[model samples]
Target: MPASADADLTTEFERLSLPLADPFTIARGTTETAENVLVQVSDGSHEGIGAAAPSTYYGETPATVEAVLPDLLEVVEEVGDPHVRQRIDRELRERVGANPAARAAVDTALADLAAKRLDVPLYRQWGLDPAAAPTSSFSIGLAEPDETRRWAERAVDEGYSILKVKLGAGRTAERLAAVREGAPEATVRVDANAAWTPAEAVAKTETLSGHGVEFVEQPVPADDIAGLRRVRDQGAVPVAADESVERATDVPSIADAVDIVVAKLQKCGSLRETRRVAEIAQARGCEAMIGCMVASNATIAASAHLAPLFDYADLDGSLLLDADPFEGVPMSDGEIDLAAVDRSGTGAVEVDE
Candidate 1:
């Protein structure tokens, strides 16, 4: 691929749905419908796909994400030269402003296109070693104890060895106990989505810790950095920063408070920015987890490329979708089969017309 081809990149967007059996809820609340933002980049014959989902936590809706697409595309079109990819990557962070999920659609699509042009797998492009990829934790949304147990049992039956449960609606203890009983052999964890106060988080963590729960995610508010540190100090269970640590700059302040940093592609703007955040977390001796925003196969593929670079991964958003557009990355037995992506870029298959 010649550097000149970089200047010819173009983008497009589409919307898709999720396949979850029931509504999924976290500390940010619940959603019955799953809407995703798909980004497609084309340079003559070869094309690449990327995906993202609007995050209500960032005040983003499908319409808002779509509205930002044109401007993001314009930025990608104007930048030229070999560094065009890197330049477009930087411009996205600057002009795109906030809304990582929106920017992620653009950045990931462009990266996919570039990778296809170079004929290389996205992970190889990022200098990641596939053998080092981390195991991803499959998620279990909130529900009645019996229902939650059923879901956990299904996940384990599906061959998933690690599970992350959504807590904080009510009956926290009972809900967790049900998951344990359901998936007795699997490693279990929970995320409260910042639903508790520091004291409440500590109390909840202490209670859940007795059940062999691995760790808790964002128990308190994101802005409560000090509160998070306190929770971390008080519990035997480690506290991971999800919403609190979005940008790379936030790393230093909460370095001592979090044992793990969850980097959501949508929350961090683009894959380039997401990688930077991961680098920062690693420097601080904190483990990195690459998460998604309830996206589709396109976006999930982009995230999967970064999975090998982190300690934890939760890229099951595509699997939850009712109809994912692209193919390539396969989610089975609690792991994403990335063998197809060995070639380059997103390694995503074309969306059916």
Candidate 2:
């Protein structure tokens, strides 16, 4: 109940309501702002920082994460070394219950602090080869057919070779065709965000095949496993599960139904758990796609540490923000340049005030 005299550390957090470049719409709803909380763990000189951005779909809000993090900070301050991440993480997961976003913030901050103490980047600390990091896909949110084409072209102009287009809006086929027309050479993945019925998903997947779409994500509702299986069986394009696989246990239940399993740090809580979920997906013969909620660079940088473990990377959460107060991983030409981030921890640093 009391920290030892040898354990002297400081922990702090702040709320952030970051604005998006545009109103981001999905099958669920639209968001013009990202509600997040930033966490920092320090032992005198060395410090590590991370952020938690809650997603409404995950049943978390900024208020909930903020309320839970204070108690979490108290528990983590007693930790002598943040490198024993599993022990702290397991305790937090147990204490925090279903609050994955809060757990992610603390887990990443401790990890960052530990890596910084060792003077090595998080990738190296985790024994992950930096070169193995995958290229990330730029997201094009839902819009009219012409606007969709414009967004696709904008992403291409910004040196993004892969585009993840948001579907489920009207004119799905035409919009996808427009996306292809805009960035004909770029890899295209579509996310319906669980907007369609099994039959509609099958038909849309068939139509999207003509547009050179690579995969369709969460085509059916999260609860509709049979529907998902029907889409996977009857559809031509590969299917990825987003809303369905929040936890590792959710993976096996839908592994046989989908071709890909999407994992997010916010939903998985800890980086360790997110990695485990990805591993589970790969072991089940499903492609592992590391995804992100609309968050700041701190969150994205934390997720980038595990980028090598995934088949696909969607670490563009910070890119959607209108302004970022921190610098984490660097993205150049749609790829995470790990060399630039080879300094310490997650390589996330606050902008000089």
Candidate 3:
């Protein structure tokens, strides 16, 4: 019998400092370590795991995630049923309201618990098609032109057919030239992380089009709806909204302005809301990308299960790590292999020392 049939849930969390393989820099800044809080839920037998990779860029830090987790866990305990996910989602929102990352940890953990109780993977629980999941893109952080060239070449040599290169702080032309010189055949995408003005974004997009880039993400400031509209209308390449589209509600306002909406569980607060954002984006005729923070496999696996519902994926957070304490779904040549995941739940197994 499944544990959800007679649920007795216990919740706990721990902070982990996951080191990066290289100093990961974006348009905003650089990060040598990713601070994630791992949350686990148990039903006396199997354990379900998830994590919160807090980003100061989104007004969350390790301290903030840790501070709010007790209340979030209290809600999980009070509910006492891992299967009652919608109720937990509602109450967690009513309770914490601000800490999206903290709530996401609990939500993902509970989802994993519920799915494991039934001995099914999360994508199976959601009734999603594994065949539909798009190939994920490996990200290359900002660096000098020579360094960018080397990493791009290395990623291609490592069998990543797709590469997401971070670009900003000027020298855009030289950096992109470096990438093209490195991996001319690899599918390339760029994310500026909201570092440009509308005019600057347009010019950059023109340059991106020249490079045969797939798309440019968050080119202008997040709040600049008018700027986004201008870029989408005037830019040479398609634009995707990552920083601007914070949740499902933000979808309607920006859907018409951009070609794609980027959804991240860390930003949305729950697995359910992430789906909502994708559904709403599709309904609005905008493509959706399942993106992630530089996080552990505990949470990346959770996001990977949702790839079947998206047009693109950027769940390469764990690949950026020096070492992850957990292992999740398998990826080969950037293909997310949810079908290859034999373990139930999110497939987030802890790595043994």
Question: What are the lDDT figures for the candidates, one per model?
Answer: 0.78, 0.87, 0.91
For candidate 3, the C-alpha RMSD (Å) to the true structure equals: 2.9
Backbone clash total, candidate 3: 0
Relative to the true structure, candidate 1 reaches a TM of 0.93
Q: Which 10-residue window of candidate 3 scores lowest in summed lDDT?
A: 1-10
- Cα TM-score per model: 0.93, 0.96, 0.97
Candidate 2 or 1, higher lDDT: 2
In model 2, what are the clashing residue pairs, if there are any? none
Tens-digit lDDT track of model 2 for 239-267: 99989988999999999999999999999
Candidate 3, 76: how far from true, in Å? Answer: 0.8
lDDT of each residue in 174-196, candidate 1, tens digit only = 99889988998888889998888
Preferred candidate (TM-score higher): 2 or 3:
3
Among all candidates shown, the one with the greatest lDDT: 3
- Per-residue error for 39 in candidate 2, Å, reads 0.4
Task: Identify the candidate with maximal TM-score.
Answer: 3
Model 1 off-target regions past 4 Å?
1-7, 80-83, 340-343, 351-353
